[model samples]
Target: MDQQIIMKIDDLRMYFNTNGGVFGNKRKIVHAVDDVSLSIMEGETIGIVGESGCGKTTFGRAILRLYKPTGGSIEFMGQNITDMPERKLRQLRSKMVYVFQDPYESLDPRKTVGSTVGEPLIINHLVRNKKEYEKRIAELFEIVNLDPSMANRYPHEFSGGQRQRVAIARSLASDPKLIVFDEAVSALDVSLQARIVNLLADIKERLKITYIFISHDLSVVKHISDRIAVFYLGRVVELSEADELYKNPLHPYTKALLTAVPIPDPFLEDKRDVIFMDGEIPSPINPPKGCPFHPRCPFATDICRTDAPQLVDMGHQHLVACYASQEGRLPK
Candidate 1:
C-alpha cells in the first residue's frame, strides 16, 4: 500500500503590504511566506521551526485558507483550494482544523466547554439532535482524557493544560483529518508541555491524524516531529527527516538553529560546536537580494550573494537550499 499524500503546497506565497510605497499606496510588501513548497503525508507530523518572524504561523494560516495567498497553490487531499469559493471551503474545513497557541484565548469565556466542543458538530450538522450533540461532546472530552462531567465548566475553570486539552477536544469534535498546531504547547509549563505532546502523539496513533507542528523551540519540535522544515526570513532553507536533519544539518541557518539547542549532558554540552548567528533577522520588506540568509551566513560566497538556491535533494530524504551544501563545501 502507498502512503497517502494529505497536503501539497506549490510555490505558496503570503505577502502583506506595509504602509507607504511608489504611488503613495501601501505597496511595500512584507514577504511573510515566499515561494515555499512542501508536501505532507498522512499520519505524520511535520515540524516547522524558525525564529518568531520567519512566517511559520502565516504559512499555516495560508494552508488553512484563513489567509488568502498572494500567489501559488495549496492542495488538500489532491484538491486545489487556493482559490476555492468560501461556501465550499467552509464545508471542507470540517476535516481541516487548527489548535491555536493559547488555549485560553482560543476558547470563548462566554461559552461552556460542552457548547464550544459541540459548536462545530452543530454547525456542520454532524449530529441530529441536542442529546446526540451532547453525547459527542462527552466523547470528545473523554478522547482527550478529560472527564465528561466537566463539560459544563467555562474556560476560566480549567487549568492551562486542561484548557489546551479542551481546545484539542474541540478540534477533534468534527473528526478532522489534519490539525495545524500553531505553537499549541508553547504557553504551557515544561511538565504540562510534555504531557500535551504525549497526548498529541497518542491522538495521532489512535485517530491517524496528520499534524503541522509549528514552533521556534527546536527541542519541542524535535520531540514531536517526524520531519522538520527549517524556515528563514520567509523561505524554507532546509527540510529533512527529523533525526537526519538534527544529526546533519545542511543549511547555514539550520546549522545555527541546531547549534543553539543545548545538549542534555554537561560534558557534551560544553564540548558541542556552537555557531553564533550575528545580526538580527532581516526585514521581510526590502529583503536582501539572492539568498535571504546570505547577509548573516558565515559560509556565504559570491553565488550566495548573487543568486537564491532552490531546495535540492541531498540523498537520504534530505533537502537543502544552500550553495555551500550543494557544492559539498560545508564545514565538517
Candidate 2:
C-alpha cells in the first residue's frame, strides 16, 4: 500500500457565531468543527464515524470547500485548497467527487437517469458528441450493474438501492481519484446497504480510489475502512485501524459507541460491557470546556472536565484523546 498523503487538514475549525460579540454577548458559538486535523492517505479508505451532529458531514464539506472553512488549511495532494479560487476549485472537483447521503433526495427527479449521469460528462466535456455521450452513460450503467435500458427512465422509476447505484455511477462519471462517501448507505434497507457496501468494496479494489467514508454505522465502516476516526461534537476522540478499533477501542467515547453495537451471539453479548450514556449530545453553541466526551464519560476525572486533551500517538498509528489513553490507565 502506498503511504503517500492525498489530503492533509491542519487545525481545521468551522465555527458559527450564533450571537453577536460583546453585547448579545458572543455568548455561544456553534463549533461545528474545532481545531481538528487529519491526513488521508492515497488509495486507502478513512472512515469517519460519529453520532448525528458530531460534525462528520461538516468535516467532509469543509475539506471539499463546500463551505469556506472558518480556520485552518486544507492541502490536496500538497496544493493548498482552503482558499483556492472558484475556477481552479471547479477543475479540481473532477478529481474529488462526493456521494450524497440520500439517493432519494440527491437525484434530480426531473432528469432521466441517462441525463443525470451524462450531466457530468457534458459539464466536463469528457465526451465528444451526443452519440458518444449516450454510449458513455450506457457504459456507466453497466459498470454499476444497472440495466442500460433503464437509462431513459426517471429517478422515480428506480428502487432505493438502484437509485443509490445510479448515484454511485454518477460519482464515477468523472473518474474521481478521491471520493467522499457522506452517509452513502444510511438511507437504504439492511440488504440494500450490504449490497452498496459490497459494491463500494469491489469498486475500490478495482479502481484504486481513495475514500473518506463518513457514517454513524460502525459495522459498515469496519467492513469498508482501512482506518477509522471517531468524532464527537466536532473533535476526533480516537483513530486506529478498523479491526483494532472494534476489538480494542481506547477512548471512553469509542468504547461507549462499540458497546452500542448489538452482538448476534447471546453468550458473547452477555460478556460484553454495556455502556449507556446519560445525556443527548450537548449543544454545539456551548460545548463543554474539556474533553467533549467528558460530559457523558463514566470514567471522566476532574481534569477531564476542565482541560482539553490533545490527540496523542499511542503507537502503530493509533491515536486517542482521553487521559486514560495517554496514561495507559484504560480498562481492559
Query: Which candidate ranks first by TM-score, i.e. highest?
Result: 1
lDDT of 1 by residue, 86-149 (tens): 9999988999999999988999999998899889998899999878888899899998999999
Per-model TM-score versus the true fold: 0.97, 0.96
Whole-model lDDT for model 1 versus the true structure?
0.92
Q: Candidate 2, clashing residue pairs?
A: none
lDDT scores in order: 0.92, 0.91
lDDT of 2 by residue, 1-332 (tens): 99999999999999977757765665567999999899999999999999999999999988999999999999997899999988889988888889999999999999998899999898888999989998999989988899999999999999989999999999999888899999999999899899899999999998899999999998999999999999999998898999888888889888889998888999999998877788999989889998888889888888899999998888878899999679877677
Q: In terms of TM-score, how similar is model 2 to the real structure? A: 0.96
**lDDT for residue 154 in candidate 1, whole number 0-100:** 95
Candidate whose lDDT is highest:
1
